[model samples]
Target: MRYSWLALICIAQLSFAQKKQITLEDIWVKNTFRPKVVPGFNAMSDGKVYTQIDKEGDRQVLRVYDLKTGKQERTVFDNGEHTLEGKQLSLDDYSFSKDEKKILIRNEGQPVYRRSALYRSYVYDMSTGKVLQIDTAKVLHATFSPDGSKVAFVSANNLYYKDLKTGETVAVTTDGVVNKVINGNCDWVYEEEFEFTRAFDWSPDSRYLAFYRFDESQVPQYILPMYTGLYPYNYVYKYPKAGEPNSVVQIKVYDVKDARTVTANVGTETDQYIPRIKWTKDASKLCIFRLNRLQNNLDLLLADATSGNSSVIYNEQNPYYIDIDDNLAFLPDNRSLVLHSERSGYNHLYRWDWKSKRLTALTGGNYDVEQIVGIDEKRNLVFYTAAEKTPVERKLYSVNFEGKNRRTLTPEEGTHGITPIEGFNYFLDRHSTLTMPSVYTLRDNKGKVVRTLEDNAALKGKMWEYDLGNISLRQLEVGDNKTLNAWVITPPNFNDQKKYPVLMFQYSGPGSQEVGDRFPVRDFFWHQMLAEKGYIIVCADGTGTGFRGQEFKKKTYLQLGKYESDDQIAVATYLGTLPYVDKSRIGIWGWSYGGFMSSTCLFKGNDVFKMAIAVAPVSNWRYYDNIYTERYMRTPQENEKGYDENAPEKMADRLKGKFLLVHGTADDNVHFQNAVMLTDALIKANKEFDGEYYPNRHHGITGGNARFHLYKKMTDFVLTNL
Candidate 1:
């Protein structure tokens, strides 16, 4: 009996010893920690069916499924059955027209920037099995007209239309020239900062099209050299730095029936920004969002399509800056509009009567509303997601338009992303927590689960092979009696008597949050790998981050990195007081804006952080774009001291510990000039630091093996320096 018990004990010991530890290769090269997710879905207009792309053997096919039964209804488009240009059609993406009679199939797209792409588009008729290519040249932002009788797209910075009935193409504007004039699309800075690429809107009646015309001849040019061969090639484009000249913008309305264009009289100031141009429900009226250079005042103007005259319907002023969002929902009545406003100190919904020009609050609380999921005008209900439970979590809620009968739809914990169908009858809720991966389920409007779509059982089972440390969501008190949201990942098999080195990661940008209640993304997996190496990874959302309140987020207004860096220093100091922390071995690292923060922390707070790794960081605010920089810090001309005081380039001499700077030479968003200038400053200060540059890589530093190589380098740096 004793021999039998010993045999069972030996078997258990062998099983425990076989479990593996996370490695850098497991994260970057092997991709063993990747999770399965659902593909993009398009809810049909019927409010009962949805469409998604699927792979069938060696071909891609579009399949429609019923929402109620969660079963496939039909195969809409089969690449094996269709042919384009004498070859079998292989669709990369597709979109349906309003009438659902035609599908726009996209293939072989070339990316221009992060959000802009040019693609070869083919219009496939559903009624007849016929496919027609719109243009021989690649086009940007291609879409069918509201009536599905024509297609509009941007080619070579100009707007062009093709009449499906006549098979003829017409140019709406002929003045589009590279770097001099741009029509139907936004400029580089606007596209990068304003978060949109398509700059044209089609009226609901299909008789008028509204677009933007930008004159960028006066803007300065920035060039990036590409070394593909022995000879270097220069790619030059117009880029406006802080306190520099912006493009002269003009809004124009084109009438399809008359072939006439009228310039909108937005305001007398030609230098003002026209961030958004949308068509109202009424075909004759167009809505425009105008902001001053300072971005403190915002005006909503209604313009006539024919007359080209505009009147301000709504005006708002913020002490600091106003934010633009996708919350301007117009009801079917055409008399009222729902606006997302921060007037209540938190982002909430407000109803505006166009005739009376009066606003009424719809949702009011201490927390902030994250998004407007759907609006059921027939039922007079507004469904939304809000951070009511905690700043790190988002929950779904439903309320009346009049701010009555508010009800929480999601009751359980975690971050809930709700996607409602057309009629608000059903929705898809995706929930994820720190310990659990995403689980997708179909639920009714009242939050009753009907069926499970994806449970990620494979990923959850595979995760048991590796050691996942304890991840805790906690708060750290900082200056001004405020608490910052933080997530800490401890090493598995932690010993209370032993001290461990710490590594901090943060993206302390405006209206951004990193410490959220979602499942482990790529960053979390990276942190887990570090934790397995006996390092505690700390991620904190400091001041100036979003999802709190307006005051908490905008406290770092004119002084961009001043308070944020101070909070990081404070966090490091507080962590030093813990029993299991190595105070002298604390390090920090980040990318982009977080990179900027790391450089600043290593310089100004050199006593707190022993090392820092900055990737694609902005050394000075003056080197950044006008819209994003000027919004927070005003122009360098106006706030010269604020721009210079917190700049890492100005404080390079204060570095005391190890530092590593990394950048991509072809990064257009935050130019490589930032790294060059910082290097020059460091050399002048007699500072010794490490540097790495990726050739022909963009801001993301991702291509074939580039990303994997970069992360491996970072892992080595952390291992040695810290």
Candidate 2:
């Protein structure tokens, strides 16, 4: 009997060992059975969140999650209605009513430009459980009024309103025609530069409709092509590159009660840009932010909705150019606005009091305040995340509005985020490091971490199973003895005796730092894969990269990629001293601005870098956007050296490596022309290189197996080409 029992135990142990050797397909299939994380999040007053998530294999859902737990509560809208009655839909976005019952679900969205899209939106009423269609699926920028009774949407390039109760649709603007007078939503230039999508806003009383009426009639038309191939056939937006004339923009307020439209008497000669309009806390006042084509001067105007009178309350100017208030927030009292400014050399927060017309520095330091998430005025506490203490690290802090009592929270280190309590009593802290996944904890207002909700123990164990490298953060002494922060990830199976190839990744844009103290993202996964196959991944935050100070970051003024190449060459110089590094096999790669840097490295630093892969790079500053290029580099004429001195097009003949230029044909951000022109220059200069053209793909070349296939190709190329 003892022998028989022992035999059974041995068989059970063998079975467990067999199960441990699972394949990637098995893991993927098993992961599909679990709940998926949805992208596109919008928080609601009822402590609920809506997102675009997949439900089964083919269908998608605009689901409502509990936020506290990951449990999904209800399916607000589903899209598989062709054959099945109760099927889930893949909603692009969902907007909630004031009461949190009625939801405007956006679907079948077609892109107009970088920041604008026309969609088939539906109105879902929670009480009746009935989904109603608005604008009959031919609308964009559908927004509900403050009362949530009336829905204002853009259709046929015109503003329209729909009454929920009466089911009546009214055309709000008659002069709205394509390429002439655009109402409700913004034009291509305004949308791309100002980042304005829903141009129209409702008054507090929902009686007035305030919007910008863009006159793009004088703007020249730019066109790209569309082709019918394997996937869906389509045409992309006609985008105007840099040095192009932007649209003439102005503001207008429409009175719903009297049916009177008043174009704000800001006067013509407004050849600049009116990017935003918001109804002030006071029902009578409407606020607008306007900037010139150079984007140097910015004005915050308070316009009287009833009288159509306007007054510039505050203005911000810089020698180079001013940046938009990306994380702008209005105080609860409605008397002041919170703004982010780089005027102090570092990005900080300032309070703009409307009544007094005074500016007060709310948060200031050498580090950048990443974003002001929440504020507790009563407690004199302002909760924000910043790169203080260390640029590579992020932490949450609650300081006084007067900028005192700055205490650090989430002392566990790495990238930290906090969700403060309703009354600023308790807070939820989520933190992670390079080797750790996200760990969530409950903390008090005093920064003491209490109950631990999730530690990501499962994910951490899985990551541990896959051998990782020693990811070290250090500072580099680059050109002219400038200290630069950098990170290096040594291959998992690194050996000092063996020479390993290196891949340098970076996005050397102003105020943009790549060397962050965050957990390994998708890039890390690929980096680990390459490291295991004998390659070192290094990221150097060169000059023009933000966070050190204004002087260090703005050194690339009037130029974008020149200083970056010099500093990256310095990185290669440093790496050559290391015994384990193969200096001849060092390569560089990036997307967009990073791509531009990678191209410059291969051409200018041909002796240092042996290979480069630039995906969707801007070959020239003159071919980029106005707001981005004009900010640091200024106009091409004002500073020709900044624009033409070291252009990738001009340095094409200097290429000494096996360069691979990849670009999506439909990428409006960095046009395919960049690739074509670079390719033409290389060919004319008698240089040998390779390229891959993805037709109908956007800036992010993602689709059914497209991303996976492309990455696989990149892996194979890097392994062989380098």
Candidate 3:
């Protein structure tokens, strides 16, 4: 009888070991674990329902759903029924006007850069069901005016406005030549770094249009070769590198009634950047964000549109650098504005009064406020997400305008993302944990769950079929004596007695967090595939990562890759001491900034890492863009040692590991020149390394079978080397 029981237990163990394992094809090729997502949900003006984009046949439709019952209320627009220019209209995206009387439709959007796209725009009136194209030419950042009487757009690098009723088009600016002047849209650097494509704003009363004009003729151009034709074509555009001359920017306000333009009294610093501009509740005042070239000083300016005069309402200064965020919200009272500041060594919400010229703290804590969800002026409550509960998780909280009555809204122990309705009476909570798929739920303003919109049960059921790994979240103390967050994934059949090879991944960019409790859909599957192959996958959020506070994030400020690499090396050193870790076979890998880190780690941490993979890495700070590189390293000219000491191009001779460098030739973000330069350095150093390039692929390196091929190659490299 004892032998029979032992045999049954052994058979159970064998069955568990033979469970279906995750495969690379299941992750990349078959896409067996992709989760269903709720895309493009916008709250309606009525505050009871939301509109979502849906597909029917080959056409797109705008369907509205009741927020309470999660049922389709009606379809607002269907591309199958709409015709433009005697052709079936293709709806790329749509936005409603302020009063919801009209819709701005975008079609045939061609992306120019990271955040800038040229689209053919049309205005559809709900009352008359009539559609009119805004312009014959493709335009960028087209939108209906606040009053819905006109539409403004940027075409041919120039700003134009069309009077909907009169059908008269007026050019706001005309000196908009290619590679010289840009009127209403941001340049590549501003679009990529400042995170804005539209460089124009409509005033509250729709009387004035505030826009930025850029003169890029003096800025040097970077040429990228496109391999689409027999003879490769060169695509050239103005791109300023580190320590290079930037476009001279000007802020101007156009008075609609007077048909005149007035230049705002921004300082005469041509190198400075005007990052943001928005109209205040009082139409007379326009809020402008001005930052110096060093990005250490940020000024919040209130400009008088009529007089073209401006005054500094608030001055923010940081010793290292000031960060830009979407946190400037004007109150309905027209006398105060809510601003995000790190004055207390953490990002918090503060109210700035125009009359008193004083700043009052509205939210105060050691933790950083992640975002401002909504402001309920009538209730004197400000809803926001903060890292009060845990750094890896975000929780919704509401506090009074005076920093009282702080209450946590989310009870679940994971990352909670909230999309509040018009009046903050209801919100859509998309919650997820490390092991759980995203669950979308509609909740009241007070945090009661109304209904579940999407539970991703299909993907959840498929996840059980695979013998996925077990994730363990831990904190390890690094060389700086600070605890860093890390996540380790072990195989389902993990044995404590056996030492497993480890693969470490990190993207240690400034103010970026990767080690969160949120589920990683595709990447998680890839990690599980690796785990099934008898390897451990680990991700550590090192120094300079966000959600901790200002000090921890800014530790590697001037020296971009120095502290970040050190923390990774320190974490690896600690992990090496573990009993189940095979220290001699450890590897490190990353992409973009992560790629940059991986290269630096393999070079500087050569004593620890045995293999490394870097994809689309910035070889040197000088080769990167002006805005991002300068903000962190203050240009190669200003801090030559900061740029030279940590750059992987300079450390090519220190490569002591099995290195694989992969890059996309058409990666405009981190240009292919970076790879060429580093390859030259490696050749000069007589270093042996493996390299691969995807022709005509962008930074993401995705299209058709590109991603699957790349991951397959990477998997083989890991299996052979690590």
Candidate 4:
């Protein structure tokens, strides 16, 4: 009711604030706002789900619910302590153990590279109602074993294991070489690309541990500066750039019982990345997903724990590269593996028999398998979400071994996800789109609605009060090959004949889809403010953009920005045809990878786009992490042209439009070096761009007065530039 009252007051304020009288119909709608994505999800292995919820008065609670009943079960966690501990507890992130016995809580985390610090961790034992710290020193990469009897963690590039029973800690690898040596974890390259943090695994019996070791002494180390500011922070980081040598990575196994260590070599030198490693059901064979430096070849090697003998059990190769995702699901039996591949031009699932070494294509179609949700081993059915409904929309479905009996489980759809519970018999779903907030529901295996969960319509009703200018969603078909799919947002009141200036946005990551039919974020607010002032906003999925199938998304394989930038220029050029778009006034922006694309556009497409904003982008691959950069462009050693020709720093001389660059001084992902390098290049080339340096903020730009100030700065930049 108070929100409703506030809306009424805002409407009254709008009456006086408007420069001229306007109607709701005159308002424009665009994909300008960027609503927060569901901040990561956590599922307790016991089939309960916990989601962060906001109450009436800004009280944030981590509410636990029975997935089957859709009933609020308990408050597992919360902000502002209400319990006896009295000390305030907030989570940067958290993970549950296999037995649902322990929770590795992340708190007071600091930024490392692209991700954050492991910092202080509290291992809360649920059964005993006891909370224990991992160590006196803030640890990094603290994780639990399969049996949950001990917790394994990394501190200062070295690995340690904690005994839950005895509360004893032992250093697993004393030779934790830094800059030159790393133990039980990956170097910068592997963390950014392969999406891994800890380079360790536990056996089924929990008696043995498998980990990765890095020798980066030979790898070139690029340097960046740290600054003191309001938060007053200074630090140094060792980074590698495109064409730089990456740490030589190796896999090793440690027998906890015997204190014995054995290095496992796949008997090959091409083991540049160990993306994933899991113990087999037998606890003697370790399954490792290894890829070449180029990332075009993927090998599933089975390493014997005792002898370290390795044999390739499976292999996949693609010209563009195989993505390192949670695509390969090892069934509990360990005899079979469910693999998702884009070999057939579509992301489809296949079942591989490890013992027989035979492959069986399970799901084949033009649509991509968004996720493998549930699988019934006894029934031999695979439950998954697919884009078959619509490229922008997703629905949960189930299919069998023979690809028979494909059934959709949801009628109300937008961007939906499921938490299958009690071994796939039931599920809890949270779904929403741009036009709506999320609604949670409970459903059964037969696709029948079992219970009502939550409908976020109230949030939408509350939003109706704002004097949001006219917003419209439009499609743009533009790219290098004239093959691009894009979406645009127009400010509230808009007229086609007025030729409003355009501001463009995009993520443009390898496997990320930014222009999906999802809730918009604060960018929408900026767009609304822009629309109120007469501007159009646009974003597109250029080549190398995700979920469109292999050929379409992989076109930018070697040269990361070539097609993406061209597509952005094309989109802006096509906007010139809209009669409402002022082609010469079009500007662009994005964060991280998006920032890379935005910078690339301002330089390569200078003739079309007038200005650009890049936040925390990689100016060169050599300065980025190895696992990610090598995947798309291979090593700079192998594809110097790909890394060199299109880098923002390399193309700094071509800048023609206004440019504003923003980055967190502590950004770990893309690194602040990206912006510094580009700035240096711009200076060397006598090119000028607006820049802002956020002190002590991480990749997400979160801190006091940080996010709000960032939005304010971006709003000012877009308004002034376009």
Best candidate according to lDDT: 1
Give the RMSD in angstroms, all C-alphas superposed, for model 4: 5.6
lDDT of 4 by residue, 1-722 (tens): 99999999999778646544222222223322223343444555554454545443544566676555546778765555432256544566777778766777777887565553667877777777677778878887887888888899888788899998899998898887668788887787677666677788888888888998888887765544445655534454455565566677788898899988888866557446677887766788898888877788889998988778888888899877888777666676767788798889999999889788788887777878898886787788888888886567778888886677777787665677787774676676777776666766667788777766566555565456454554434555554346555556666656666877888889888877877666653355556556666777666777777777888788878888887787777887888777777777888899988888899988888888888888888888777766677778877778889888988889999998999999987776667878888999999999878999997677889867677678778877877777
Q: Write the candidate numbers in order of decreasing TM-score.
A: 1, 3, 2, 4
**Which is superior by TM-score, 2 or 4?**
2
Better of 1 and 3 by TM-score: 1
TM-score of each: 0.98, 0.87, 0.96, 0.85
The lowest-lDDT stretch of 10 consecutive residues in candidate 1 is 520-529
lDDT of 2 by residue, 318-380 (tens): 766666755676666767877788789888888888788778887777887888867776786
Which candidate gets the maximum TM-score versus the true structure?
Answer: 1
- Deviation (Å) of 156 in candidate 1: 0.5
Specify the poorest-scoring 10-residue window by lDDT in model 3: 519-528
Question: Which parts of model 2 have CA positions greater than 4 angstroms off?
Answer: 1-92, 111-114, 229-238, 266-268, 332-335, 377-380, 417-430, 440-458
lDDT of 4: 0.75
- How far residue 153's Cα lies from its native spot in candidate 1, in Å, is 0.1
Please report, in order, the local distance difference test score of every candidate based on alpha carbons.
0.90, 0.76, 0.89, 0.75
